[model samples]
Target: MAKVNKRLAVLVGCNYPNTQYELHGCINDVVAMKDLLVKRFGFDPTNIELLTDASAVTGEGSSSVVLPTGENIKAALSKMVSQAEAGDVLYFHYSGHGTRIPKPAHIFGHDEAIVPCDFNLITDVDFRQLVNQLPKGASFTILSDSCHSGGLIDKEKEQIGPSTYRAASSLSYKAKNIPFESILEHLTTLTGINTSDIGTHLLESFGANASLKFLTPQLESELFDFLKADEGILLSGCQADETSADMNPMESGGKAYGSFSNAVQ
Candidate 1:
């Protein structure tokens, strides 16, 4: 195990206030993670940034808290990575909604993305890009408690899976299908134009940085290059082909909780 000279965390939780995608336990999930980092990992309270919709409710005295909008989340992540140095341990925990977008014409299957409160997405490519910014000897760990979160770290090897059970390292698993209608609605929000054509329209309107372009073909060497240089681990709630349950059981004090988040905490 690598000793951590410095400890930092960026925890984001979203309840999608007043929206159709409202969730109940995301804020609680972040709270739990914040507590764990403070007590279990010995992270300084000042070194953690908690971004969530419940900032007003939970962040009474914390000046560093903010809402989990796409812009805010991205900026917080950038700051966390920018401030890290060698031998530091940085942990990012996201407890919220996730979506699977259609892969580009050149690629096979799908790509995974976390849904921000604004419905703007942060995809796996974006994460790998962030990981690339880490200084040597620094480690970045991601814990995603959301739907379709598997492979969020992009081409990182699997230590536990069908591959581990099989004779060799290669094992195939089917990815879950996310509705195109839902994906299109969210993607079109930025461009204000809706078209059945995904590739051309998104490319023309939003260009490369567009959320959907994360699935588009890129130089594998550069996009996945962090796997070679960085110590990053992604612990997802469920497999790519599985749905994670968000349970609000009456027996559990009528409070909602992500099944995976509750289990991990």
Candidate 2:
């Protein structure tokens, strides 16, 4: 294999302080991702940095620090990305509760928002800003183990997941559906897959793929194929209609199942 460039991993778990409202599964997810990078992908443990609610400042190999809110999150991200250079791969993994806010004026031109932490809500525009800050040729991989992430799929339809106004007032957002209109559009033009055929193929493949029981084969295949395109990869926990479990009944003080963290573990 050709020599691989240096890689930096940022793993965050939000289960402790400052995030009481949102369950913190980020720490576990980060730890599991770290193990995968080191044991399976040959990444040097020294290159990894983990931030959670329980760690201290060590500045050593794969150290952990506690972050309670969004301000701290932005600062840490800025610092880490500053160290990134060409040919570098930056892996960002976040596991926690996701809140929606009214859409921002710049992107959606409506009222929809997702709270990233106690201090601030992360809008699509905010995410785009972060992405724009990255150096060219740098690969950015983001895995979000939370609800309402389908918002990343398209800006036009900010209202995904069963209409937020329906029954069971406790459930605010739809948990497991990925709106693939844009993805289908892109694939259709690029690969000549008819839109209708694309949907059929995606459905068939997502439903049949057994590796991930939570996702239909068509969705799975679409996501897998989409990731292969190399633009960006997003792996959510469940379909838009389903709710991902947060606490595994078998474990205590640790996050539950339905989180992608369990799969990564």
Instruction: Write candidate 2's Cα lDDT for 159-199 as tens digits.
Output: 32443432332222223212234333433555565544443
Candidate 1 deviant stretches above 4 angstroms = 1-4, 59-65, 106-108, 162-180, 187-190, 197-221, 225-227, 250-254
How much is the lDDT of residue 218 in candidate 2? 43
Q: Residue 80 in model 2: shift from native, Å?
A: 3.2
The per-residue C-alpha lDDT of model 2 at residue 228 equals 26
Q: Find the number of clashing residue pairs for candidate 2.
A: 29
lDDT of 1 by residue, 61-113 (tens): 55335778766787888898998898889999888888777765546687778
Candidate lDDT values, in order: 0.70, 0.49
The TM-scores, one per candidate, come to 0.80, 0.57
